[model samples]
Target: MTNTTKTILGLIIAILVVWGIYSILQKSSEPMANEPIKIGFIGPLTGDMATYGETEKNTIEIALEEINQSGELKRKLEVIYEDGKCSGKDAVTAAQKLINIDKVHIILGGLCSTETLGVAPLVESNKVILFSSLSSNPSISQAGDYIFRNSPSDSEFGRADAEFIVSQGIKRVAIITENTDYSQGVREIMKNIFQEKNIDIVADEIFNSGTKDFRTYLTKIKSVNPEAIYINPGGSAAVAGLIPKQIGELGIKNVKIFGNFLLGDKEALSVGGQAMEGIIFSDSKDLTQLSGSLIEKYKSKFEKDPAHDALVAARYDSVYIIKDAIKSCGNDDSDCIKNYLYDMPEYSGMIGSYKFDLNGDLLSEEFVIHKKIVDGVPQVIE
Candidate 1:
């Protein structure tokens, strides 16, 4: 071959090699369409609130299976669960591992208020999206822009409870609160509203968490003989269940028994049995409308009914909400997902339609009163 021809050929080969290298670099920079997107889950898997975590985890399993089967996203979704044990310290640790080690940009977790409150700062600092379904502490409304919860805050619960109390012509009321972030939040809100509405707070009592024997507090509350008592317990379901039993055993009759959302806990109701009967509390609107099949599926798979169907439905919806956010805005883009959720349209799901406000709280939440009846079943009285 001629020298000029050889030089021309060499130039062409060099250009092709460089172009191939550039093309390869471009492809590497872009995300793989089939790569699974990883998300983290934090919950109290082994502590007093373990039922919440177990039920939530099971719900997530069902949701993930459905999502994967539907092929909704370009990539498959994956989750790494870390147990928070219903405490702030453990929740922080779980968040760190999921954030720093797993490198997940979104976390659905910390079912208990303490768990969510504990890791709010960590996730916020890292700009990771934290979504919760069970936490209801009012403080969580201001936790951070990245923090979001579908459950109505305790502020709403307190209002509904207080209103129901007033509507029943209960003038004097007593409050027994567990010393925890969740319970304290409810306590303060109820106290303020009761005073505002001219309802007398006859006996205000405080108890430490995990206090199985609440006869002392119940006796103190009985001495005041308030027409109604608000029992607010934290992660310890036993505290919730036994408090009412103790009250009943103390012969505190002809008095109304009021409680927070925790009163719906299956463990509490089961433990409290007949004593828990007729006790009233406020909760989200009944979700049993569409939960029949889901509950059957849950029972078939786990061989047991979910502890709280409303909460289970919320957790299931949370997975889809996250999926929608990630699909709308590319994966791993926490800011985009956060903004998408903030402006998300009315999402009608198992828990009914709702939207998020600027504070990452539900714009409108429907709270209704429920009464504990036979076999620990919660019947919506209103």
Candidate 2:
């Protein structure tokens, strides 16, 4: 080989060596750009309950964005969402995938109480912390230690509703609930409370969770001629549509309607309209007052105002609580975070003051009674 060619070949080899070392150093010294603390969410992304799921997903996204912007945590927060379809089987499958495939240490969802209950055992056995934002069925908390809920249980809401009913002197009442754990639980609690208050239940009926035709049930309720009707339909959009339409068509003007928090939604307002004019409900917090700047931010991002979906506020607060717990625990260890959550005294959230009890349920004293306005907005009725 010529001397010049030999020199060029040697220089090329040296350059390649230098580049290889540089690449190694770059890869070693710099952390992966995509590294994130993963949290799993399981909800009904594609069913009658999809509205709730979408609200939750949006709230979490907003919370993460704010947290990341603030740079409050050492690790960037990332959420992985799975569609539970509000089904127990789907919830179990989603939970397993989140645990085994995604390797998520913490899960923040399963909107439906049935879904939450279905996944509770698996999550508990795996020692994974599952924080439910909206599943209000009491059995969820009874599932295990690893299962935690930030929202008030159906019992709480039912008691509040019953109190409202008693205050209004509603003696003769009717109940129509969807056939699901949440609706049934609320109905049972409210029934007990009403009985205790000496209120007479004139009509009691159950409808399928996603049923669109509640005419038969409404007709039955009308036939009973109860002074008030308590509709606990498990937040199903179809029921939301049917209830108001049927009630309006049935021309039940004087009858008062009591609803669960699940009925507090845009779709319900749009469909229920004049029929929902005087309907009263017990809710965790007044969304309009509870959500301040967060509501504005949500509106800007989603092009719509946040409605009565408690899951939105709950999910947002859950993220902040997780952040606070992480900060308090001083690490990302699951046990440490769990301990911190249980030990938390009082964390002011959008909803109200949040402090976890021994059972990891948030204790708060700010629930409100709201009555639907003629314009479809809910106004706090003292």
Candidate 3:
């Protein structure tokens, strides 16, 4: 062969070899038949709500591990957790990063309502499906079709609380809540319900979100001699520690105390102890029953019981819900998964039977009333 022709042929062969190698690498890098699915988790990992966020993360991790090991979903699932710090700006930033950088198709959390609201617009604009485990603000679901929550809205619990108190034949009630949106929202609903039922609201008090001294408010509330005191402050761990002591010091043991789901934590139990005994609250599900063997397993694995009770169940169910939706779609196409989720029927989850409504809110009427004891242990009353 001529030298020029030889050179050209050799170059062509090299080009062909390079192209073949590139094609092989591309094919190998593509998603495997049994590749793991990646889901983004955003919540307050390091802030006032960090305990709740960490609890949620732990639950999600355990659920993912179980699902992956069981092969129930038929695909190994992985979750990438981002700390939103329970701030709107942080949440929005985290959502954007999850969408643009990680490219996670489905995102879970922003555990607080304010954070969820801030992140909703970003998730909707990007067409990413966002699920919250504990945000109860009704407006979070109202934002767009992309937003969905496993937790019951505050309104549902608020109404149930009102009913429970009224059922107890308590004619006079006082309202106290934190200044946050979730606390305010629940307080409003309870107040409206009290008005509708013609129950006397002896006193209404609002406290700053991080207020440590609640003696003034509690004392003022005590003066009314209400049959019951409704404290809507969801994250009242700080206040709970002091309120019980002050309530006892004021010689007001007769005034029954009622709390929202926020008072269900171990912190309340640790702080209030016997003083918290007999305090009533409403919950979406009975954690003691719902937790079942999962709690024991979690404690063994993590050296501590799961933080938020049925919240871990909610996180667990979110994975299965996504898996079901993915199976229905039969592909990784975002639009297909989105459509499948919309059409999903009532699924029996660890928390409850979940079926999304027109506004992407889960339609499940499964709440129970409970009371706390010295150990902060919750017992279902009805």
Which candidate has the top score in lDDT? 1
What tens-digit string does per-residue lDDT give for candidate 2 at 61-179?
Answer: 99999999998877788899999998999999999999987778789888888889999899888888889888889776578888788888877888888888888888899998888
Off by over 4 Å in 3: 1-35, 70-75, 287-291, 372-376
Worst 10 residues of 3 by lDDT: 366-375
- Residues 164-216, candidate 1, lDDT per residue (tens digit)? 88889999999999898888898898888888999999989888876788888
Ranking by TM-score: 1, 3, 2
Q: Model 3 clash pairs?
A: 273-374
lDDT for model 3 comes to 0.79
TM per candidate comes to 0.89, 0.86, 0.86
Which lDDT value does model 3 have at 330?
A: 70
lDDT of each: 0.87, 0.80, 0.79
Model 1 scores what on Cα lDDT? Answer: 0.87
| Full candidate order by lDDT, most accurate first | 1, 2, 3
Instruction: Give me candidate 2's TM-score against the actual structure.
Output: 0.86
